[model samples]
Target: MNLLKKDLADGISFSGEKDGHCITCLEGKQSRNYSEELEGKCLQLVHSDVCGPMSQESRSGGRYFLTFIDDHTRKVFVYIIRSKVEVFEKFREFKSQFENQTGKQIKILRTDKGSGYVNRDFKNFLRNQGIKHELTIPYSPEKN
Candidate 1:
């Protein structure tokens, strides 16, 4: 430290202080919390998410996929589509089939606030069905 100060140093300070908000260390930390608990019965709280627009397509030319999971049963239903526009249609199909088989109407729909779930058509459909729609905060996938 003395040699560095005397020989080649310009304006460097050698303090023993620590940075509490060190970006390098913070960036390396992963979140370590368990997800929120799932409550209620089958068809009472349904969670849905849409994924992809991948570069590679399936044999049927599908590039997007949608998933519906029952909170109580953890039963999942999935559908593959060619585009986002088919989201409402897939929801309708899932709702009808699941409700018919389970004999219980879906009470709440939980999803991230993506355009597929927040659009006018989807909103109207949920409203007409009397199903409450719950959206997690934007950019927080862990909340979903």
Candidate 2:
């Protein structure tokens, strides 16, 4: 274990044998990869996605759930809607609430290339507000 090595280097002694395999050490070894930096606080960067037309409908006759995730705080906002057409209205509500609460404008939005997000109205709204919209390439949820 790197911790054990560091402890031994710092003159700390352990009664255990050094020849034995350390689970912690083995688990700790990993290849590093670069990850994108998270935007700080709320309303800075939001990832939006629509999930499901469930096999069984909800009590309110809703089948899909739209989720908005704050990149920095990892807070999630979920909206249950009957159709994808409601995404714009739900997103508008989310935008207002997030900005009101955090006092920060949403700078960028990341989402898959879903029509719910990339439609003319949504694109125009983002452009008019000077917000940067980022969309994943077709068939690439991993990018989003």
Candidate 3:
């Protein structure tokens, strides 16, 4: 403290303050406490998304990939496809496999409001299956 005072007195300047003993800068900073609700296991909540039409196609002639992520287990299922049109079928496959493997039904289906998911057939299927379907607000994945 004396040295810093002397330096300032002598018109010496530094970019930031340095405590001689600690060799660190002191600056105004802020932090916040963040809390999150615990997430349940896989087969409990799944996140689904579709990605791509690559410049180049895969060996299977797939240009896109559909992903189903088990939120709790962090296990991911990726299905390659040539179009978004396959999302419904791929979702069905995921639903069947996940249900069979875990012996637990998918309680919710979440996805962006893509045409593939909002069509009459898809809406009817979800209604008939008694699954809760949640769609993200337009142009927003954070809401999903």
Residue-level lDDT for 27 in candidate 1:
51
Q: Against the true structure, whose lDDT is highest?
A: 1
TM-score of each: 0.69, 0.69, 0.66
Model 3: per-residue Cα lDDT over 63-86, one tens digit each: 998888767665789999889899
Each candidate's lDDT (Cα)?
Answer: 0.80, 0.78, 0.72
> Which digits, one per residue and each the tens of the lDDT, describe model 1 over residues 12-126?
4543323533344355565533222223366788888888888899999999999999887777898999998899999999999988776679999999988888999999889
Q: Whole-model lDDT for model 3 versus the true structure?
A: 0.72
Candidate 2's C-alpha runs over 4 A off are 1-41, 138-140
Error of 1 at 25 (Å): 40
Residue pairs with backbone atoms closer than 3 Å in model 1 (clashes): none
Q: Residue 59 CA error for candidate 1 (Å)?
A: 0.9
Worst 10 residues of 2 by lDDT: 31-40
List where candidate 1 sits over 4 angstroms from the true fold.
1-40
Model 3 alpha-carbon miss at residue 102, Å: 0.7
